[model samples]
Target: MLKVTAIAAALLLSGPALAQHAHGAQKGPNGGPMEDVAGVHAELVVSGQTVAVNVFDEAGKPVDTKGYTGSVMVVSGGDRKTLQLTASGNALTGQAPGPVQSGAAITVVVKTAAGKSGQAKFSAP
Candidate 1:
């Protein structure tokens, strides 16, 4: 009984670490929420009609955007829009054709030059 209780306590204590690894509960370097997708880190930031996604390596250093491609999907108030993202400087950026609804939920999927893909989710403030 004591061994079982100990095992349960250990699992409970490790739950957050497991969850974070699976769901990326880390904050981004670009002042946005970040997620871990397949060991890469992605950050999503939304401003008005513009959406930016930044990718980082496991060590939190910004990854080169060269040859990287991605897409963004904005969801708000039951409406959804998809935008193509291009590498700009060190980040992937795109603009919505129409004004982005405030408080929209943004999801970004990025593929690196080596073909590794990662995604991040954020909500516009």
Candidate 2:
């Protein structure tokens, strides 16, 4: 029935497994790929063992992240790890379990202090 279908759609969109993967965004000021996440832009940067996500507004200007929390899910070959991020300066930062493998795929998920959530994905360079 229509009611059942609507309920299912709502649940699907609100579930943890539902991530709006934005892949067509241009590179950001930090030389990382930027994607529209929630109501802002998120740039994913991986260097050494650090995974950082820079948040920006729709205009690509850096934004404040004082109350934002985020995490990075890195997958390379058969290895996978989730890094819990901490807001540092104006970016959300986390430490990977090991060196980020070449050609890995990264997904950055973030939530504001008010509980607004969004996500962005990146392909390793």
What is the alpha-carbon lDDT of model 1 when measured against the actual structure? 0.79
Output the lDDT of residue 81, model 1: 88
Clashing pairs in 1: none
List pairs with backbone clashes in candidate 2.
Answer: none
lDDT of 2 at 29: 89
lDDT of 1 by residue, 1-125 (tens): 99999999999999987776544445677777777754567777777678887777777898878988989888988888889999986688999988777678887788888888867677775
Q: For each candidate, how many residue pairs have backbone atoms clashing (under 3 Å)?
A: 0, 0
- How much does candidate 1 score in TM-score? 0.79
Model 2, 1-125: lDDT tens digits are: 99999999999888755554444757888888888777788888888898889888766688889999988889998888989999977799998867897689998899976789988778866
Query: Among these predicted structures, which one has the highest TM-score?
Result: 1
